[model samples]
Target chain A: MSKDYNNFDYLSVSVKSDQLSRILQCYRVLGWTEVKTEDDKRYYDMSYVRLRRPHKIPNKDRLQYLQVRMESAINSLVEIVGRAHVKSTAVISVLVIIFLVCTGLAAWQFLSLNQAYSQVYGWICAVVACASALAACIAGACLRRRERRAAADKISARLKLMQSLIAEAKLLVPQPQNEEEERAGEVNNG
Target chain B: MDKSSRASHSLEDRSRRRRQRFTEDKLVKIRTEHSAGSFKTIFAALIILFQLGIIILLGTLPAFALWWYLLILAAISIITAFSVLSSHRAAQAKAVWVLFVLVFFFGGFIIYFMSNDKYMYARARRRHRAIFARSEKFLPEYAALNAAPDMKLTCSYLSRAGKFAAYNNTKLQYFPSGAQLFDDVIEKLKSARSFVFIEYYAVSDGVLLNRIWDILKQKAEEGVDVRLIYDDVGSRAFSRGMRKKMRDSGVQVKVFNRLISWFTFAMNYRDHRKIIVIDGCIAYTGGSNIADEYVNEKHMHGYWKDTGIRLEGEAVDAMTLFFLRQWEFITKKSFDYSPYFGHYQTLYSPYVVAPYVGGPEYELTICKSVFESVINSARQKLYIMTPYFIPDDSVVQSLINKALAGVDVRIILPSVPDKYYVYLVTRDNAEKLIKYGVKIYYLRDSFVHSKLVLTESCAVVGTVNFDMRSFYQQFENGILTDDKNVVAAVAADFERTFPDCDHPASAAKNGLARAVAIALLRFISPLM
Candidate 1:
């Protein structure tokens, strides 16, 4: 067989001696144990594992394809999560700005009251500052709670997508079969 | 089975259920919280806060040490607080007394209290009696055929004023929004004969305003006397260059009470009046401002609702006089009213329109008086539509009393509030009104900025809100019209808006959430 040929792996696997044994070995290597074979043809007809790629000679191209797909999926997931994080951070920044401005204004007013040196002025300034602070704290707390809830929602959605991907991966691999016939002689020996 | 695998399976299942439940609960909470009725709870809390502030101020001041000074201060404050608390004839008087006390202290208090008694007694004996004596002079004697007592009283008052008040012959048309009104105004400018006078609270330059400005320039070029008066604070966004451009085009513009220097807090009193009189024959008044959003042509706030009335009648003379007085006040030009009122004509019109003007500088709050008169005169039905509904105690009590007296009193407010605390206060007041058998409807589509009042046959439509600002402080105007068709038209619009709203049985229907809003708003109502 010409090793550099594009179709050489398919041709060599078909013509190899003990083709059925080679297919069974490929299934085992791929962690698929629910497939069966009759004569020289391999078949895996199960509801749990539908589509399968036939066994072939191992090569760099096939390995590279799988690796690229995994990388793309990981990259997309990271980008989506990153965008959500950015949005949350931006909202938090706005909240912080408002809080700082309110605090600064209140402090300025309070200090200005010191120039007045009147008890009534001081009390009024203190009341106003307290009110502003209370309002700011309430608003900040509400915003933070909303952000946390949004994060929890994002995480739950991501987890669900991950579970779906795992199920899809399981479907892509071939299964093994005919274990009962192979283990008959071993059971008698035990 | 492995312990870790089994535990992980159970954990995943539990988390999935929890997440689903959490989202569903959150949606329900959001929906309930978003309803318009939630504002009531917030307003109740604000009222409580206002009460607490009054108490604290009263208790903290050194009252015993300065008994006379403190007593006068305390009396004015208490009277003001009581006015805020009660629905009585004393509300306007009390508010005036509060301002009087602030200005002259003890001396002002005595002067005001004594003058107030004399003022009421004199007005009752002199004007009231003279109005009745001269009733047959101006009003058609047949006017009393189906007249209510309040109408009869108003007719008599107008009859006396008609003897001296200049009358003009003109046409009248009512527009439901600022957009349509402005379009008509631009057309009127094209045909302006002498002078064009404009006074408004807010006049922002935008697409619509720019178009109108072009017409105003053309009119000014044609030897038409053009004058514009806008409140300084209200038109804060307008540029100095824009003013110069208008002046360069031969148009004279005056800013009412320009905030030039510090210690001008007294200038806080705004000319909230909206009036446009063209060549002394045509005039316009209502709640519409010169903002693009008012026309639905701009996307500032979605669907702004407003109304304006076009007047060309004896009432137009009254409006012209009102504008000239303000023009004199702002420009210091001693205007001989002869030019404005000497050429008045009486146009026999299908609609009987009377324009009432009120301001803080006036000895009496005419707006509050008109409100009391209108509220007291309701027979079959009363309908109101306002953007803000934070009324002083008297107005609120009038509404409650009217509803309880077997009158069909309905109020329509915006479902989406423009101001948060004002919305809350409105909701709180609505809740109280609902308890007194008044039907409250929220306009679900747009913000209803039109300040209008409709009884069985007549209607009052203008820029005055039901709040203390409109009643006691700001300059406001309204047209009292005896037009059954206009009243019916407005009432029908209210009918179309009512069904889209959601009316809660009470603010307490949501229990704890309502309680929290009510508690919070009570401490902040006065500021609202």
Candidate 2:
């Protein structure tokens, strides 16, 4: 039933069910509390359960504002991810080229190795290959470390935003009223 | 109080404090006003005391003649002291004049008295003849443009030294800026064959100098006689280690008159000339120095505007002599002129380039005479650009009188000046000139440090400014050329520059401020 009603505007209006659910998922993935739905006619109607805007909101309209802010955050994260991917691919290609050059030179030297200079030439080729491989590995490790750091920062930012949204939802929730007192009196009489 | 009012008050207080600090930080004033009575009264009192002493001595001893001689000696000493104190050049010339006076007094008084008038007349006649000779040669160049009759007479008077400044086959190329001149200099240095001689006022260690040093070092290694002479005061920023490095690179270097004693401040006469001679074939002279700032690679005191002339002809011989004279004074070694003379072969060119050197030490003040000649020779149009516009009274009068006679006289100075007080004086002088219908243009982009003067056909571009310092103290070089092409080129550059500048007529100032500026400038113009 929730899935069928989950219609959201990632391009326009931000107060749709799927948008809130995605934010909620981001919060959960980032170890933040999930937002709770409120069920009180005085505070909100059934539409409000779908994360509709309030009629007369006090303070700032932070939910919609947070949606715009989160969109930009996501954009910047995607840009960083794109740049990292490009850099990784560039590094991999350079490493591949260097490895090919080193291996080709090594093979050529090995083939041309004569009776007197065969061992010396073979040693030089081996040393060159080892050095080239070491350099490639170091470059790959550095690129990976940078990519991991960016991912971690993006996740932490998303978690913080989700936590704030859950707090806002708690503020919007209605408290249980005098019906509980009637129930209590009935139990006492019994 | 409101916030703005309180802020303004605080700002005013800060400004007042800054003004006070500025006043306190000023160096002690070198010039002061003295009442005439102070010196006159002192002199009268001293004369009375001296007469009383003479009377007493005559009464005590029988040495009347000796007393009279002593009195005469005292009078001569007083005259010498006054001359030395009043005139800047008098101190140096005093010794020679004193001997003349003494010889006249001691021996053949009658002969001296009789010959003095004749001697003066003969000297005047000789000068007049020299003037006539120079005018006869160069007056035709300005004959058609001679609208002012008095200008011809002034020119004739000023061109007395033109006989010494004559040249044969020559070519002159005027560069509007130091950077352009440096480009030519690098090209010339690259082409130097036997020897490269450079004497500059200032040379600092920087990228431009380093590159020049590199080229010079290479040329030296290739058997070229590379020598350099720089003023000690000018090279004060260069470290000893830097000098050592230059010496290690095989370039012979000499510092001109290194100060050894405090009294040597009188050696304040600097070699302000910028001269470069390559193999006695090509030469450059004018205001540009060998520093990155001059080349505009580094901004020193803001954008640099300068002019230089490259010469290739008999004029190079004059430049060689100019450098050699200074070299002899410093190094006491006379270089053989024969080898250098061989390279001064005449080039068949239409341009008439006359390179001249000037200083107070010379037998004749060539720079002063040339400036006066050019100023007086200007008839239809007189265009001048100088960093410093402090002209002696004669030059100023000539310029003002020419302008009054309806000549299209224009002067260009720097809008953004390097020196504030000097610029103020320059503006003040410009205001006076403008009042006489002279057009004044303040170059807006940067400092216009080029000392350029253009007439209808001929032009003089050089290192010397129209200042007392350049005229009376510093050694300077310039090219006086009658090349129509070069003149037209300079005129075109001036035309392009004139519109972007502010004219004195358009300056925003009150009449009272203008009067005050003029008065202050006139009072201090002599010292400046």
Candidate 3:
């Protein structure tokens, strides 16, 4: 049945769990009013948010494009957040191998070499092994921290871009002057 | 013969015995259910007890003499007769009640009081009315009333009396087979975004329900609002474990008229509607229920032929309302229904679709009226298909009248009946109509579960069968559309079915004893 376009068009968007508030904020500027929010039952890390906008809004294509970009930005932001928790396996592996090699050399000097060389060379190798192990711990922690920082920086940039897109989108779709206008504008605009 | 040949003959005898044993077991089960009896018998027994109490109380009272007691009984009978006369029951039904009252006196009067009391389903009816009233604002007014000029009067009647509006820009798709409808239903459910509302009479445990449950579970997990309502008696095979599984997955479940929970005869009024509304955009309704037999995965009769129709766009709003009305009544909670109604731009279409509902709450039998309207409007042809053919006298008369007026009237019923007693009555009714020049056909080896009525002007496809239960006793929904495409599709289905159906001549068996049995069964068919 055809109705006077006074009705609102609705959309449902799913995003990572903690990101709902920010997504709603951005969507609000894009003329979407948050209707309800639900946590995904299967995916604990995801949540669904339903939003409605005036039907037949001006520049719908541009607004939809911005919405897609905003969603993509949120997706990338979630991936970056996940990436921050990722450990640098390559760095950890290299450090572990170095630590093991030094320990092996120290064992060889202490157990198989002659007494004179064993005392001197064994002490040097033992010190080197301990230092390597300490270095492995320090290097692994530093690598993880650096990766997290880089991920945070990328996320911040993406958030800024998303915010700018929302602003552009907001300008494309005019805000309603009043409640009555908002309700009636959907039909009149088209 | 050799010894091997003798052994083969013995093996054949054993197989034959096993087959006979299986058939005997099935008959025994049916007999057990029949012996348990129907609601009418139980209610009648209760009414007799009430009458006995009144009689004994009057007889034992010291202040009242035997003459006084007799006088009181006479007064009560007179009052009850007046009440029956003033009531809105059909003329024929009222006549039957009057006959019973004169024959059985106080017991019959008490039976009428108990059955006609609005107190039976008062709460449910009140809530349903409220829900429907509240939904009226959310529904946009019918804008294309003149789209189908030929059926304007019927549409107007439904809009005024049934509270259903004619909708345009709503697309209709007809499915000739249950399997195909289900395949499409599964696919459509996969695309659901906001919500899925399901209401059905029966949801037997089978591959069909399992597949639907899988989709519903996944959809619920994805945060879609998935709500299901099934009649407890109809879906008895839907195990508690399955219900818990659905709940655990966040699919909201509600059982209509739980037989054990409700200590009343209201349980007899089952929700016999088959509705599946997906996000207020697409909906499906017809004779098919959520069961294996509907899809022919498992057969109780032989081949099960069920039909369904899919609605896309605005007509779906009415279906959504139908589900919510029942849901609200069962749950006793109101909801903000605005979010579920879709906003769509008006697309131009030639056909007009009006989806309507009927139940005990409405005084008028809406389903019967629609059937009559279609029958009355048919000048050239009228075709009908149903699993059961126990229509009330008015509907039978309408068919017979049309057939006599030179309209080519035909009805197709199931040959392999799920219930033998009901089938006998159906066959007997068919025989009566055949004598009036109405052609009746039985689909051989198959149970046609489709509730369809097609004529030259319009068509009806929904859960409303040509039976008293669907017409008066149960809550039902149907689509009354003048869509040429839909009507043509239904006509085409009937055309294809005719060849497969056996005429009443070969399907009927005449005998005095069987005739007496059928007469007895037909008399109580309305109570059934």
Best by TM-score: 3
User: Tens-digit lDDT track for model 1 on A1-190?
Assistant: 1222111111111112223453334333333232222221221210111112222323222222222233223334435455544554565566566556655665666667656555555565556556655655665567656766776687667556444544544454432346684355224422
Model 2 Cα shift for residue B23 (angstroms): 24
The 10-residue segment of model 3 chain B with minimum total lDDT is: B25-34
| Worst 10 contiguous positions by lDDT, candidate 1 chain A | A6-15
Report how far off residue B81 is in candidate 3 (Å).
3.3
lDDT of 2 by residue, B1-528 (tens): 999999999996665454322121111111111111234334544665565455445533433446777556546545654543454342323344344445433322222222222232354335434433433332223221322344334333334454334454667777877766876788779988899999998787765676577679889889898888997666554556767886887888898756432321224467788889999998888778886556554443435667788888766866776676677667855445546654766776654556666664444566877877877777699899988888776778888899998888999988766767777777776767777888989864467778888888578888888886787666787877667778898898688668756786744454887668766655545534
How many backbone collisions does model 2 have? 0
True contacts kept of each: 0.00, 0.00, 0.00
lDDT of candidate 2 over A68-187, digit per residue (tens):
234334434445555655676688678778777767767777788566576677667677777767877887788878877877787678557556755654454332245586345334
Q: Point out where model 3 deviates above 4 Å.
A: A1-190, B1-71, B117-119, B144-148, B261-263, B343-347, B505-509
- Per-residue lDDT of B1-528 in model 1, one digit per residue for the tens? 899999999986665454322211110010111112234334544665565455445554666577776676756755644543353334444555555456544344434443332343344235333332433233222232344467656544544433222222335676766666877787787888888889988776655667678878888999888989998766664567778889999998998866543322234467889998888778899998765556543433334667888877566766776777677667754535556543434666554556766765554666766666787788889988888776767778888899999999988877667776677767777777788888887754356788988888677888888776687667888877665566666677566556645565555243687667865654334223
Q: For residues A30-79, could you state the per-residue lDDT of candidate 3 as single tens digits?
A: 88776677754334455666666764467653465465456556666656
The second chain of candidate 2 has a TM-score of 0.70
**What lDDT score belongs to each candidate, Candidate 1 first?**
0.59, 0.61, 0.76
- Which residue pairs show collisions in model 2? none
Candidate DockQ scores, in order: 0.01, 0.00, 0.00
Query: Which number leads on lDDT?
Result: 3
Docking class of predicted structure 3: incorrect
What tens digits encode model 3's per-residue C-alpha lDDT throughout B1-528? 999999999986665454321211010011101111135445654775576677545444632546665566656767788777788766555666776666655355655665662666676677777777888886667555655455787887887786788898888999987876887899899999889999999887766787788788889999999999998777867878889999999999999877553234565788899999998888999999998667654545666789999998788888988898788888988878888887432556668898999988787789888888888888899999988998888888999999999999998998877889999998888878887889999876578899998888789999998887888889899998888899889888888778767886534676998889887787667666
Which ranges in model 2 have alpha carbons more than 4 Å from their true place? A1-190, B1-165, B506-525
